[model samples]
Target: MFYEASDNDHKHGSFSEVRQDLVSGDWVVIATGRAKRPHDFLQEGKKAFRQPKRTCPFENLHENALLSLSLGAERGKNIKPWVKVVVNKFPAFQRGVCSIFHKTGPYQWTDGVGQHEVVITRDHERSLGQMADLEAELAVRAYQERYRAIKQDECVRYISIFHNHGRGSGATLSHPHSQIIGIPVIPSDIARSIRGSAVYYEEHKECVHCVMLKFEKNDKKRLIYENDHFLVFAPFASRLAFEIRIYPKNHVSHFEDASEAEIVSVANALRVSLGKIFKGLNNPDYNFFLHTSPIDKLNSFRHYHWHFEILPKTSIWAGFEIGTGIEISTITPENAAEFLRNIKV
Candidate 1:
């Protein structure tokens, strides 16, 4: 159904109509005047963009190290380093007073009480996708360790772990690194996802993610990559072209709850997914983030399952998307998955 801005509905002005998806109950905006054909999104000669190593910040991050690991080293010998976890020099949220949630008239706010840290690898040029299998495993281990540490603080309600590759995905530094952030409140997007998952769980008496995985595995059309423990596939209602999600076959609620074997498998799955995108799409910019159960309450969110979402910079949001919180993809997810699945990384 379409919802146009009537005289009373228009607070400022009316330029677009809102359309709701019948199945997911999600809303989207369609601008009347501004629209582009799908062919406009296809351009030629895309190259992988990277910054030079001379001015790279991650190269000199030893002093800020919160945790460092040398993957394979013998006792009583020099240890060659693999990964380092350090406090982000510029943090979005910091250590602060968590007690106050002040309200001013109709507005409510609080201190930006949180922790932000970066997981950096030793290599300057190799991203997780290009890194060796062992290096990728170590990087995943670093993410888990930092997550385990940060969630212990009583002030933290949610933790986010994500990686931004290439310039378009919002990576300022040329070197590859993942970031972990701990915040006092659950983000609106995550809250909405949790609510949806909860509703599905109550209605079906099964994990919604598991149900999706089963269908995707059986169909094999939308499937991009899969291992013993994890499955990577393009979502049926993908918000962007080449959108990928990696879910553990096991119904684990928390990222930190994954066992050692599970962690390695997840790392492998992540590596393969990124590798395929890097090779197949001519190294397009992309962002991958984790969605897990909130750290505040464990048993309450048992219905929720953790997963990774990779969103490549395939298209830019225009007026229609900005006006109404909706995105349009130029390509079908099935085709995108098939293309990526055929790529030999």
Candidate 2:
């Protein structure tokens, strides 16, 4: 209900206001300019395409696996690996020796000198949410192993680990896989997040995320799932309708630093959260990504806490979001969390 406008007159210029979110300190545009009724966002459901295993590129992905793990003898030892991490054949950022910044026409550029790997699961249909808890744990272990290997290079400044589920979530292939990209510079979104947390830490001398976690745990209004080491909750100022964030219970600055027990707990929490979403919402498309401390400045980023976030494609972006850089989420996070929490996974 909160909005900001250039002028007080609501009658003129399709008046809109930019509201600053208290938690992340990011702005959101309440576009009364083109406001939408709540129910208008409940669009028709999408049909997920299932490509045949014969045509799927990942089905033959047996070679160049950076790390591979097996399920059990039940699946038979001759079967394809249960989970594997391999170099992305078509990488956004190609691997090469680290490069120095070179100037060109008032712009700076560097060789995309970083590793891009894909974490593939053997199943063509079973996503993380649908997989067994043990299977999900193995996949998460692959992520950690690759992260540990990629972060060792001094040239690498940031590592992005993300999963694209379904076609709507930008998955060109139907197979279940996650991507890891190492880059030379910190992404702008992550930089902003780090700076915001750093400022809060300077003011309060405690982890900002920990403070939020404590409040959310006691409040219980936004919490959906929790384990010994992690909690899943809808963010207070969600950019998307059903945005979910998974945070470690203990304050950990780096994802790579998580212990084996902690990783398993996180995997459990992640699987449950995703399962609830899949069941309750009827398998919506979504993207989940990890946010962790940059590899270059470990000491300075200690105040920052690492977490994973999932954003479901519940709504589409229109002019207001594109023009103002602020997204309008129709559903309040509390309601979304309640809906998700009540669903049995």
Candidate 3:
């Protein structure tokens, strides 16, 4: 059953209710018990963790590099690379026999036979938000290139490309880097998202994300930023405060399929979006990840529209959230979008 409140209750700012996600069909509570104004989130919670440059592993790239890009002049041998992709020093998954589930007394297991790599930008201190548009584009290009290479492995079924900004966001090192992990199995959350999208497509014959993007673009109330090829907006059912999503204007299932122009546009969109949060929210801890179709059966997920989701560390999940599997957001997306949209980043 739906948990909608009366219009008057919402108008009075006294409503605590649940909103269903159109794509994933998951519900998130807009709990007024812990309500917060958009600006109130700017108040510092925990200080961001920092690491010294001398001790940082990414400061000097001595590991066997998988892929490297140099934006500067290539004439000199000492010209440091702008962006580099290297295998994770301590990987959660490694090369092995293809994963196949084996029975184990009412339980099942498979080998963690996949690839994990780290994408490192040259600067230890410069984050994506602080990077120039071209610099950010090279990083995104690295993610796409590595994803293309990793997906070629027959054992890889899904690849996750994500960045963690602070200790709160699971970042152990202060160096600005993103991780790419290829897995033998599809994650439950991603599987649910794809299933929901497929269901919606079967019913409406259209991409669910494209439909949402169309409305968000037209509504403008939740639109934070938009370039020629991409749009950034707070989701109508944002699961957290200051949650932002960047979507391509056109429907594209695979991130690797994006054109060079589209890549540049997305990098600009990402930089601006993160810059706004960095300036407006006092550089809060956050995590951003790319959500795209799985590697196998690409044609089956043609209805999927790939995008990036940025979730700022706004509130902690307590019992109601963790136990119920429903996140509670203190601020509404409309207000979050309005606040971020006005920030001159």
lDDT (Cα) of model 1: 0.81
Model 2 misplaced regions, further than 4 Å: 1-19, 29-45, 75-81
User: Which of the predicted structures, 1 or 3, would earn the higher TM-score when compared with the native?
Assistant: 3
- What is the per-residue lDDT of model 3 for residues 70-168, given as tens digits with 9 covering 90 to 100? 787545666554999999999999978896899999998999999999999988787999988988999999999999999888999999999999888
Question: lDDT tens digits, residues 210-282, model 1?
Answer: 8888888988878999898999998866777788999999999899999998999999999999998877766
Worst 10 residues of 1 by lDDT: 7-16
Compute the lDDT of residue 66 as modeled in candidate 2: 89
- Tell how far residue 324 is off in model 3, in angstroms: 0.1
Best candidate, lDDT:
3
Per-model tally of clashing residue pairs: 0, 1, 0
Q: Candidate 1 at 266: error in angstroms? A: 0.6
Comparing candidate 1 with candidate 2, which one achieves the higher TM-score?
Answer: 2
Best by TM-score: 3
In candidate 1, position 228 carries an lDDT of 85
